[model samples]
Target: MTATKIAIVGVGKIARDQHIPSITRNGAFELSATVSRHSGVDGVENFATIEELLAGRPDVGAVALCMPPQARFDAAWTAIKAGRHVLLEKPPGATVAEVEALIAAARDEGVALFATWHSRYAASVPAAKAWLAKRQVQSARITWKEDVRRWHPGQEWIWQPGGLGVFDPGINALSILTEILPQPVRVTAAELQFPDGRDAPIAAQLQFAGASGETVSADFDWRQTGPQTWNIEIETNDGQLKLSSGGAEMTIDGKVMMQEADSEYDGIYARFAQLVAETSIDVDLAPLVHVADAFMLGRRIVVDAFEM
Candidate 1:
């Protein structure tokens, strides 16, 4: 099988840390080019903008957008219009509407559009989903707290309006929740805690309701100092299910079920290859929709200023 020649439009931390390595290891893809003003891969061709990349490398059949959410729509739309399959990083776009528009544009151009949720591809996520499918969920709780300085470093875009702040990492848990739950859920209430001068929140508390009267609550904070936490616990009639280490480990009522290394982006690129081959679309907006609802219904609270 001939590998799909692909270009990555952003060369930031995630691009360097996850996307590039995954693409290199995946036989289905070749990292032919990149679009970044400040950086590029060692051997790949680089362009300053998406327009230049799209026009210069017409043979590059696919594009992976690892840019921030605020600037993703235009680049993705440009790639799709240029007849290239597109793979979006999580929280596909700044708003739900723009992602929807990209879906339509990809359909019109007959190209694949994959809005990836990397956490949903974790090693134990499938097991959790399968177990939950057979049980009656009593309630669920998500406690996702991480130090932003450690994960994002000096990336100031996160504190901006479209950057999603705490919800940036929080949405990963939401993605897992949407994937594992037998029933759908919607946000019922939220309290967002914003730093004094920031446009986005540093912490958030959310309440969700399922159709069967099951309640879900989430607590997300970016101010955690040590060890970090990314855990989801669900109470069921049979037993308790818990997923920790961002879904890399699963425990049921105190027994270790599954544990494995993080290989989510690999699965993402693998799925992208399949989508590109079939010329299909696989954009799930359930996670993004829950974030949108959280913002719309959340009450804002001012907190102390944050600095890097």
Candidate 2:
């Protein structure tokens, strides 16, 4: 089969580090073009905007939108209207309603649409999910803390409304949780800590309840200065299962079961290829819905201003 000609929008750090490399390496896709206001990929056609890229590269069959959540809806809508398949980064849109709209548009246009959660494709996530399938979950705790300056330095949009702040990374944990657990969960209460001058929260505490009566708690903070942590621990009827390093490693009862390097974007591209071929849409909105629910029902607290 001929490879799908794909274009990338938003040539930021993720597009350069992950999306470009993954698409170039995947046999099912060919990197045909890029659209960015500032950065450009070498050896590929580049355009100043999505409009120009779409008009210039008629052969492109799909697009991977690596832009921020706030700007995703417009580009996605334009692409779907142009009858191109779309692959969206996590937290598909700034609002749940926008993603819902995109879903309808993609369906109406009869094109593939995938909202990728890279962490769900981590090396050990499936293993954790399989292990928990037969066991009873008692409780779960998720701690995702990192230094935003190190990860997203000088990205002012992160502090603005719709930037999602710490939830940007926290959603990764929720994605994994939603995937690995045997039953669905919902946010019951949330406490968000916003910086003095920021519109988004820098830290958050959330409580969740599973359909089977399991309890879950999440703590997301972007203020850590020392060792970074991305971990999820769950107590099951059999033993304790811990997924650390953002689902890259797994342990049961203090015994290491799995550990490997991450290939999240590679898996993302692979899944996108399958979706495009099948002409199907694979978008799980549970994680984003939980986020919206948190914002809607969460209590607000003022915290110290954060500086990068």
Candidate of highest TM-score:
1
- How close to the true structure is residue 77 of candidate 1, measured as C-alpha lDDT? 95
How would you encode candidate 1's per-residue C-alpha lDDT over 1-308 as one tens digit per residue?
A: 99999999999999999999999999999999999999998988999999999888899999999999999999999999999999999889999999999999999999999999999999999999999999999899999999999999999999998999999999999999999999998999999999999999999999999888899999999999989999999999999999999999999998999999999999999999999999999999999999999999999999999996
Q: What is residue 52's positional error in candidate 1, in angstroms?
A: 0.5
Candidate that scores best on lDDT: 1
Question: Model 2, range 1-308, lDDT digits (tens) per residue?
Answer: 89999999998988888998899889999999999888898898999989998898889999999888899999999999999999998889999999999999999999999999999999999999999999999999999999999889789988889999999999999999999999988899999999999999999999999878999999999999899999999999899999999999999999999999989999999999999999999999999999999999999999988787
TM-score of each: 0.99, 0.98
Looking at candidate 2, the ten consecutive residues that score lowest on lDDT are: 36-45
lDDT of 2: 0.94
TM-score, model 2 to reference: 0.98
